[model samples]
Target: MKTSDFHYDLPQELIAQAPLPERSASRLLHVPPGDACFADLHVRDLPSLLRAGDLLVFNDTKVIPARLFGAKATGGRVEILIERLLPGNEARAQLGVSKPPQPGSRIALDAGGEAEVLARFDDGFWQLRFQVEGPLEAWLQHAGQLPLPPYIERRPDAADAERYQTVFARETGAVAAPTAGLHFDEPLLAALRERGVQTGHVTLHVGAGTFQPVRVDDVHNHRMHSEWINVGAELVSQVRRTRAAGGRVIAVGTTVVRALESALVDGELRPFAGDTSIFIFPGYRIRSIDALMTNFHLPESTLLMLVSAFAGKQRMFAAYEHAVRERYRFFSYGDAMLLWPGEGESGSGDLR
Candidate 1:
């Protein structure tokens, strides 16, 4: 299919400029697959709608304050975003500067010192080891700012320190927040736990590429961005046990789905920790995950492609249209949706 297949019109005013007062207070719109009818609901209705024996899988990857600005030795400005920390104190990063930074050049950060680039990774990526004079993690907390998406068109403030993260966040790695997980609070999670819903966690450090536009005319030719994911033995066991007991595995976001799917090697899920560039689009058969709870996505985004794969292309667009007509808020700080596999896309054993 062409990239234009998933295109939808959204009003500029609907793009959320600020987060809602409370995370759970955001609105939800539930749309059934292959149908046009959509019901307006609240995010708190999640636990009530899910069955008791279902396993709710959430991505526990934490977003680090990875956006850093500094100066090159020549006094030119440079913006850096830490993509991943490699072994031996080495780090892979993306650099945005007036001119490309050269190897062995120094980037002086505001925290009293600098780092020198050892090599160039790719087009705009650099591999550098820090001489921070202290631990890099501790240095970042005091120096870096929140890595807000470019579409936001504003500066990060105190509220973003808390509002931009999910309550379940634990392991620090992600550059971008798994926005789907942001809606669940302690109370909501507690309620779900009390209702006999089992929960499992995985880590998939979301990358900035998640928000990148698909510039290709043909969607199939587009290459996905690489992101790190870890699925431990414990998570693999939980998913298998859930399936054994005829319980559904509900993935919290597209990131979790990729982690779970990437771990599925040789027709069975296994523990996996590495970079995955898996891309899911319409007509792709899902090997795992029965249901998906996620937020409304950007137009022509890969996220829309993943959701469209689970729900049929026609059904998914119908749901998106309903959301637009109902004045539903869109993107990061916007509303959410609960979806089951479409008629032809049965997630569990109930194929139509």
Candidate 2:
């Protein structure tokens, strides 16, 4: 399908500049599975909306401060946005410099460190190895700034230190947060546990490519940038039990959906760990997830395409228009929607 099929007119003011005072204070648009429907609600009303048997699958991949300012040895200032970490201390990063830095050169970051360009990979990324006093991951946690989406104009403030991440964040790696998980706080998790709504976590370190715009006019031609995902025995058991009990397996975000779906093959969801470049477009089959709670996505984006696959292109776009018409905030630091799979792509669809 054409990327334009997913487009909508969003008022500039609807783009959220900041998070709400309370994590669960954001609005929630409920898109039911039918031609005759949609309802607006609050995030706080989630507990009552769920049943005891329903499982809320969340992505626990923590966002790293991946965006950094640096200078090449040639004295040109550059910005490094870490995309994926290759094995053995090497990382694939996007170099935003006056001119792209050459291979095997030393570039010093403003926060205090230098990285040696190892080699250039396919496409725009360069593989660079950082010289660190401590582990590279720990250094990023302290020195880097939150990798907020480009649409968010201001530099990340102290409040963003907490608000941009979810309460359950662990297994540090994502450059971007799994936004649908952003709505839940400690109290909300406690509430879910108290209500017998099962909760399980998997890691899918969201990459900077998550917000990368889809350049293809034909959305299906776009290839997804690979990202790491892991679904363990616990989540599998929970999903199996949830299904056995006739309960819903609600995915928290597109990240969680990819993590679960990437592990699925041959009619079974195997525990998996590796990079997944799975681009879920329209007509793709969904095996495990029954519902989704996600933030509004950018038009003509792979993320938008994924949502369109879950909910139909028409329904999802209509819901997006509704959000815009109702002034629902947009993107990562924005309001969310709880989408029951559209009537055309509901439960028991093929995984492969």
Candidate 3:
């Protein structure tokens, strides 16, 4: 399919600029199996929507304050977005500056630190060595700002430091949050537990590339972004046990879906820890998840393509139309969708 196949008409005003006061108060559009019409509900209703024994896999990769402002030794202003942190206070990052800094050039940070450009990759990323007093993570906490999505017009504030992160966030690595997990709170998690739903965790350190647009006309020509993922033995065992007991494995976000699917070995999930560049579009049979709970994606994005592959392109477009007509919010800080595989799609069957 063409990249344009995933495009939807989302109004500018409908793009959510801020998070709701209550995490679980956001809207949820339920797209069930077959040709059933979409159901508009609240995120708080997830416990009731899911059955007992179902495993909801969540991505626990925590967001880091990765955006920083600095000036080159030449005094030209530059902006940095850390893509991946590395050993020895080094990192791979994307730089925003009038002129790209060459290797050996030093950038003096606004927060009283420095970074020396060590190398540049053909993909537009730069490797840098930090000149901080202590650990890079600690220096980043004091020097960097929360990197909110570009669609959000306002600057990141104190509230965003908390609202943008999920309550279950523990493994600190991601530059962006696994947004579907953002709607979950302690009370809601408690409710799901009381409903007898089981939970498991996967770690996929979300990359800054998640926000990059699909520039190719032919969807198949686009290369997917790579992210670090870890699917542990415990989670793999949990999935097998759930399937044996006839319970569905529901993914909380696209990152979790990617993590789980990438770990599949000969149609069975295995423990894996590595970087994955797997691209999911129509024609790719998803064997990892029975349902997906994810936030609304940008028009014509790779994320939209993944959902189209799962729920059918036509159905996703129709649902997006309904969301727009009903004044539902859109994007990272926006509402969410609870989706089951469409008829004839891989993993579609009696979910009960």
Candidate 4:
């Protein structure tokens, strides 16, 4: 498939600039399998939409304040977005400046700290060794701003520090929040629990590259960004037990879908802990998740392609049209969708 295969028209005003007053207040577009039609619902209605024995897998990766502003010794301004933190006090980052800093150049941080540019990584990330007073994460927590997506017009404010994170967020590493999980609050989770729906968690620290556009026309030529994922043995067993008892494993976000599918080895789900660059496009076989609950995505994006792969391409496009016609919000801090695998798709069959 071509990258253009996923393109759709979205008005600039429809892109969500800020989060709603309440997380569960966002709209939900439920697209069932083998149908072009969809049902309009809200995030709080998820409990009624799903069955009692259904299991929801959520991404527990927490979004960190990764945006930083600093300056070179020559007073040249520089912006840094930490992509991944490495061992030995090193970090992989994207540095924005009038000119790329050379190796050995030091960048003076805002909070009376500095970092020396070590080298560049294979994937175009700059390696830096910080000389901060405390740990880099701690320093960032104090000085950095939340890394909001480009679509959001305004700057990150105090509300983003709490609203951008999910209720279950614990492991702090992601530069971007899993927007689908953002729709779930304590009340919503409690409702699901009371309805007898089981819940589990996996961690996939989403990187800044998630917003990178597809530069190539051929979908197969695009390369996915690497993100750290951990699908524990307990979750794997939970999924197996759910399947045995005739329950569906529903993924809360695309990150969870990728994490669970990447953990599949030899046609069965297993525990996995490592970085993955698994790219799911149309025609690709999905093995782990049964349904997906996710936010509407950007046009021609890898995320859209993954949804097209899970659901049928034509149906997914039609659903997007419906969302546009009804003026549903788009992108992060936007409305969500409950999607089931279409008939004849890889994830449509029963695991048992």
Highest lDDT: which candidate? 3
Q: What is the C-alpha lDDT of each candidate?
A: 0.84, 0.85, 0.91, 0.90
For candidate 3, report its TM-score.
0.97
Q: What is the alpha-carbon lDDT for the whole of candidate 3?
A: 0.91
> Per TM-score, what order, best first?
3, 4, 2, 1
Worst 10 residues of 4 by lDDT: 343-352
Error of 2 at 99 (Å): 0.9
* Per-residue lDDT of candidate 4, residues 47-82 (tens digit): 998888899999999988998889998999999889
RMSD of each: 3.3, 2.0, 3.2, 2.8
Task: Please give, for residues 207-283, the per-residue lDDT of candidate 2 as tens digits.
Answer: 88777788888865777788888899889988988999999999999999888988887768778888788878778
lDDT of 1 at 8: 90
TM-score attained by model 1: 0.93
Query: What clash pairs does model 1 have?
Result: none
lDDT-best of 1 and 4? 4
lDDT of 1 by residue, 1-352 (tens): 8989888989988888778988888888776655657788888888877888899999999888888878998999988888877766567888888888888889998666787888985435688787775677777778778898877879999999998899989989888999889899988888998988999999999987776789899877888878988999998999899989988899988889888888887659999998898888876767778889888898899899889888778888888888888888888888898887877753321111
**Residue 165 local lDDT, model 1:** 91
Ranking by lDDT: 3, 4, 2, 1
TM value for model 4? 0.97
